[model samples]
Target: MVIGIAVIVLVLLGLTFCVIPVVAHRFGEAAERAAETEAIAQGARGGVLAEHRVRFKESAAEMAIPFGIAAVLFALAACDAAGVGAARVLTWIVAAVLLVIGGFVTSGQLRAAQWTAAAFRRSSDPVVRGLDTEAIVSAAAREFPAWLRPLQVVRFLLTTVGLLVVIVALITPSAAAHFR
Candidate 1:
């Protein structure tokens, strides 16, 4: 039962932290690029450029659902309501892996957003210049809640702790039994 629950949680974490964001970011990038292309083609200004910015913002907002789900799962795990039992070590290992992957994904997204914003800033086009690049970039990069931002450091700490726990659980049979 514990293994089954851990598997389910792993699948959910993978989808929530990995698959969903990649898809959303790609689609959002496509939409933003398409809108920019159209605007440039039409020599348009203001409305379409604004929509392009909105697309970036929307893509960032798209993460809210996954974040919410993750938060709920986190709360459940914290409360020890996530089927903690014989598979505790497995659970911790899976969580550490997921956290590492999630960190990469999140940093990649932020870097992409910042790169895109930099490109816009460097553009000679009047339409691009008219839009507030700072606001757009902030919207894209500020996907996490303000309070949650500080916890970014905690992610690394937790990953280290999780890894240590897994190591201890592996090397010591008694510790492994305790984890179970």
Candidate 2:
């Protein structure tokens, strides 16, 4: 039972942290490109300054939520693996709360992305929106918070600990069974 729990936790952490970020990043980039392409084709040539803020907000939120959730899950998994039983429950509650906050922020950022796209579509300027769509895309994608990398480092340590616990649990089922 503990083995099962450990496997589930590890798999979820992998998906949440590893897979989701890549997928969400690609999704956000695609959205930005599509929005820009459609706007350009529709003759809505504007400047970068006009849409930069919205794109930054949307991109930052897009990136932050997955990373934040991954960090929280790593912490929770480590706690669970340590047999911090009640603390695990509290950690889960904390994760849920953090996720809810991320959701609200991400949702608002998505709206901002939509608004940026709409602005591009409705833009009356002939400025061409700074000409290089790639630059705009890259700028937004790179707009992550400075503090995110430190959190990622902490997540990495927690992940290492969690994996070690799983390895130990697998090698001696009885020893880990109590954790279940």
Candidate 3:
């Protein structure tokens, strides 16, 4: 039963931190490109400022890279450690919160990608707002804050503690001589 639970959680942890972010990055890049293409085709001329839309998508993709690795390592250590119990639960909780934040922020990149794609599609469509694509996107892009910055620092600390927990869990052994 323990192994089963461990495997399932590990799989989810892998998907959440690994697959989602990577997949999202690829989509994000594509979306950014599509948005730019739409902007250009819409008779929007060239400039570095207009290209900023593409850069945001790339930044979002870059953000996902770390969280992906963190997820796998975090889960691997988590599964091997004998579940959250006793004082260790606090450690796990902190790690979990950090992981959640990391995952959410990383996923936001993917969200941004989707948003760009939809924006392009909307701008091109006759029924939609059809506002100047570059103008709107560039304006919005300037205002978007990097959502992952806070998560990056907090999760780094959390991951360090989690690693220590894994080490302690590994070395301490589950068969306590005290109980015997």
Most lDDT-accurate candidate: 2
User: How do the residues 34-125 of candidate 3 rate in per-residue lDDT, one tens digit apiece?
Assistant: 54555556655443224333344435647566566556455554534454343244434544654566556544443554555455454444
The C-alpha TM-scores of every prediction are 0.40, 0.43, 0.41
What is the C-alpha lDDT profile of model 1 across 1-180, one tens digit per residue?
333343344344434443444445655565555555554554546455564444542366677766664664454354333334534545455556555765565554445545555556666776664555445444433453453333433433433444344334434544334345
Q: Sorted by TM-score, highest first, which candidate order results?
A: 2, 3, 1
Assess each prediction's global lDDT (C-alpha) against the native. 0.48, 0.50, 0.45
Residue 171, model 1: lDDT of 43
Better of 1 and 3 by lDDT: 1
lDDT of 2 by residue, 98-130 (tens): 445544543444344445545444545555432
TM-score of 2: 0.43
Error of 1 at 31 (Å): 18
Candidate 1 lDDT at 85 equals: 57
Question: Whole-model lDDT for model 1 versus the true structure?
Answer: 0.48
User: How far out, in Å, is residue 116 in model 1?
Assistant: 3.4
Q: Which RMSD values do the candidates have, in order? A: 8.9, 10.2, 10.8
Question: Candidate 3: lDDT over CA atoms?
Answer: 0.45
